[model samples]
Target: MSVLQRLLFARPAAAYPTHVPLTGLQQGALTVLSALGALASPRRADLVAAVGETSAGPALAALRRRMTLDPRGADILAERPRVTDALLRRAAALPPDTFGGAYAAFMGTRGFSADERPPVRFVADAELAYIVTRAREVHDFWHVLFGCHTNVQGEVALKAVEFLQTGLPMTALAVVAGELRLPAEQRAELNRTYLPWALQAGAQAADLMCIPYEKHLEDNLDELRRRYRIIIAPATAGAAARAGSPTPPLGAAPPGFEGLGPGVEGGTAAQLHETSGRLGPV
Candidate 1:
C-alpha cells in the first residue's frame, strides 16, 4: 500500500482513553445533529452552529427516540456488520445501478461523472472500516429515503442523516460545509422540507447503520420512500443546466456526490464537502 493508504488503514497512533467511541445511542444522537446540520445546506456548518440551541437540543434526542421507538426505517439496520473489505466487495458485487437510474439521470444532467477520487478499494479500518464502508455504500438509499438530490442542500441533509446515523467526522464536515453554500431562503426551506423529517426519520427509522445495504436491491423505491415519508422534488437540475444560466445554488449535482463518478476529476470529500461522486457501492 502507498504511504497514505497505510496511514488511512493503520490503527490510531494511540488509543483514546476518553473516546468511548459512539455507542448506538450516542451515534443516534449525532444522527440528529448530522441531519439538521445537512439541511442548512450552503450553510450546513451553520446548521452545526444551530446544533447547540439548548431548546432544540432535542434534535439528537428526537432521532434516538424515533429509532428506538419506531419500526419503519430499521430493518436494514439489523443486517449490517462492522466495516470489512469483504463487505465492500459484497456491496460492489450486488448490483450496478442499484442506486437507481434516477441517480444516473441526475448526474448526467450535471455534466459530471465518477473519477474524482482514487478508488476506495480497501477499507482503511479492518475493524471499523466495514462500518464506514457500509455507511458510505448505503448513503444513496438514505438519499432515496429522504428525497434528497445532488444539491448543496441535499448533501447537507444527507450528511446530517449520516451524522445522526453514523456520527462519522466526515459527515459532520459535509454538514458544516454544505451550510456555508446556502442562502437564507434555502436554509429556511431545509428546516421545513428536510430537517423535521430527518429528525424523525433518523431517530425512528430502522437502524440503517447496521443493515446489509446490498440485500435491498429488490426492494421498492416508492415503497421505501413511502415507508420513510420521503419526498421527491421535480428534477429541476436538468432545466437549470439546459438554460445555460449561472449555476443555481446547491442542487447543482446529484445527491451523495463526493465527486466519485466515471470521468469527473479533482474534488474529494477532503477537498470539498460539497463533493461529487457516482452512485456506486464503492
Candidate 2:
C-alpha cells in the first residue's frame, strides 16, 4: 500500500465506501495490514476491511457454484435472502427450540444485536457483494449451529472451521493469529478438542453459506443440523459460563446445540460433556 493508502486506513473514523473497488495488489496490502489490525482488536473496522477484501471474491464464486448444484441452495441464490432486524425480531417470538428462537435467545442472552455485523465493502461486483454480505450476516448463525461462543477461544475455533469450510485466507489468518494469542490452557484445549472436531465437522457439513437460513428460522435446530449434515464439536469449558446453564457440569450441553442428530457420531456427544464446556452468542 502507498503511504497515502496507509494513512487513509489508519484512522478508523475515516469514511470508506460500502463497496470500495480495489486492484489485486491493493487488496493484498489491505489484507496484511488489516489482519494485523484485526489481531490487535477483533472488532476494528480495518480488520473487517481486510476480511472483506481477501475473502469476498472467491467465497462469492464458491457459494454461487455450490448453490447452482443443490436445489435449496439454488433457490437461496435465486431469492437472495437476507437476515434483517425485523426477521430476527420475528424469530425471537418463535418457540424456544426453533432455529430462529434459539438464535434470538443466543443473541439476547449475550447482549448481541443482529445488526452489528459490518456491511460489505471493497467488492465492486453487486452479486459478489451480496454473497459476501450474506456470509458476514450469517456468521452468528454459524456460531449457533456449531455451539461456539463469542469469546477469544470460541471465535478463534470458529475461524479455523470457517477457513476449512470457505477456503478464506482471512479466516485462516484469523485462526493462526488468534490461536497464538490464547492463554496456555485454552490453547491446549483448542488443539486437543476443538481443532479436530472443527475440521471434521466443517468438512462433512454442507456449504453453510449457501443455506437459506432466513427461510428456515422456524425449523427445529437439530433438524436443521440434520438437514445440513452438521456435526458440532464438543463445547469448551466456557460454554456454561456463557449460556449460564444449570445442568450437571459433567454431562451438560448448550441448549440449541445439544442432542445428537443422525449424522453425528455417538462418541462426539460423550466427548462434548467430558471436556470443560462453553458456548455464547457470536
Candidate 3:
C-alpha cells in the first residue's frame, strides 16, 4: 500500500487486534480536534474518548507494564475482561452495602451506562489498547470508590486523582480544562477542599487497576474502602449526613447501616444510602 493509503486505512495487525493504528500526524490531528470538541462540550463522551485514545500510547504502555508487575493485574492482562451489561446486572442485584450494589446505584441514579464508554482504537499494541479500555470502563467505579459527584467540581477533582493514578495526558488536560471553566468561588473551593483531598487520596490508595472488582462484588463497601485506603471527600460525607444516611465513622465499620441494605421498606433506605453520600449524588 502507498504511504498515504496506509496512513488512511491501516489494517489491524495480529499483535494489535481491534486496533486501528494511526500515523503520528494523524494522531496529533485527532488529538487537537478531539480536545477542542471535548473542551467545548464536556459532555461529549465520544470526543473525550477520541482525545484519550489518540494521546494515550505512552501512558497506556506504562500502565500495561505496571499492570504486568502485579499478580492481580497480570491476571487481568491475561483475561482481558470487559465491563458489560451482564456484569452491571449482577451488580444491581447485590445488597446496598456491597461494592457492586453501590456501583449499580451510582450508575442507575445517574442514568449512565457501562456501554457508553467508547472503545480504544488508535493505540497500536493489543495490551495497551486493553489497558486504555480498562481505564475507561472502570472510571465510574473510581467515582463510586472516591465519592465524587458528576458535577464540574467533583469531576475536576476526580480527574486530578485519575491523573495521579494513570498519568494519562487526557486526564491532565481534562483537569486543566475543568479548572478553567469553573467560577472563581468553585475554583477556590476545588483548590482548597477537593484538590488537597484528591492529592492525598490518590497518592495513598492502592493501584486501582489491579483490583479484581468482579470478585469483590459481594464485599462490604466500607470494607473495600478500608482495604483500598480510600478517603471520601468531607463534602460527600456531610451530604450523606444531611440526607440522614450517615456513613460509618472513619476507621470504624458500623453494624447494619440503619437498615440500609436490600429489601428495606419502600427501597428508600438503599437508595438514600447509595445516593446521599455513599455512591455520590447523580
Candidate 4:
C-alpha cells in the first residue's frame, strides 16, 4: 500500500491493537463519516475504507461459514490465496472467453487495477478479517461473474445484487446513494431494468463466498456462471456471451448490464446469515 493510502485507511505496521477492535461509538462515527466520504467521492480509497470498516463484521462471519461448509471454499481459506494485479495481467492473456481472459479483459478494458481495493482493519477476528479482505479483493471477480460494467449504473445494479447476497450495509448504502447521484435516465434504467434483475439473481445464485475463483480462472466463463446458478439478463453482452455468441467490443458503451439475471425476494440471504451465526469453529 502507498504511504498516503496507508494513512487514509489506518494501515499501520503493528496491524493489530493499532487498528482492530474499534469501539461501538467509533464504528458508528466512522460509518457515517465514511458513507459521507464515499458519497462525496465515489471509489476513492479513503471513502472505501470508511464503508469497509463499518460494514465488514457480519459479512466476514457469513463468508467464513461459507468457506467451512464447502470443500472448495475450505481449500481457499486454507490456502489464503490472493489475486494480485500481476495475476490479473497474466490471466488477461488467456483465450478471450475464458474466466481468466474475461477478468483480464474487464480490468484492462475498464482501466481498473486490482491493487486499488483496501485491506480490512476493523474486524476483530484475524481469520474473519482475512475473509473480509478476501471479499473486497474478489469484488471485481463478482463483476466478472455478473458481467456488470464498472459504470455508476452498473455499480449500483451490482450493489443491489451484493446487498441481497451478503446483506452488507455498505452495498445497500451504495445502491441508495449511487441512485441519488445518477442521471435521471440512468436511474430510471436501474429501476426499470436492472434492480429487479440484480435482486432476483442475488436471491437465486449460490453463496458467492463459497466459490474459489482463483481455481476457476481457466474455466469457460459461461459454464461457470451456470454451475453457480447465475443468469445473465436477456439482451445484454453477458447474455450474448453466455449463449456462445460474440458481444460488442469493450470499447463501445456497455448495454444494460444484466449479467446477473432477473425476481422474487427469498430466503437465501437470510439463510446464509442464520447459518453463519450457528457455525462451529473450522
RMSD of each: 12.4, 9.2, 7.9, 10.0
lDDT scores of the candidates, listed in order: 0.42, 0.61, 0.69, 0.63
Q: How badly does each model clash, as a count of residue pairs?
A: 62, 9, 0, 2
Cα lDDT tens digits, model 3, 49-114, are: 677777776877888889999999999999988887889999988887788888887777766667
Model 3: lDDT of residue 145: 79
Task: Give the TM-scores of the predictions, in the order they appear.
Answer: 0.46, 0.73, 0.79, 0.75
Give the number of colliding residue pairs in candidate 3: 0
Candidate 2 residue-wise lDDT, 122-213, digit = tens: 66566666666666677778877876655555666677777777675656665675567566776787788777778888888888877878
Clashing pairs in 4: 197-262, 231-261
Model 4's lDDT to the true fold?
0.63
- TM-score of candidate 1 relative to the true fold: 0.46
Best by lDDT: 3
> Any runs in candidate 2 off by more than 4 Å, and if so which?
1-17, 23-25, 39-43, 236-282
Worst 10 residues of 2 by lDDT: 273-282
Which sections of candidate 4 miss by over 4 Å? 1-21, 36-44, 234-282
Worst ten in a row by lDDT for model 3:
254-263
**Predicted candidate 4 versus true structure: per-residue lDDT over 118-148, tens digit per residue:** 5566665767766666666777787777777
List of clashing residue pairs for candidate 3: none
User: Relative to the unseen true structure, what is the C-alpha lDDT of residue 9 in candidate 4, on a scale of 0 to 100?
Assistant: 53
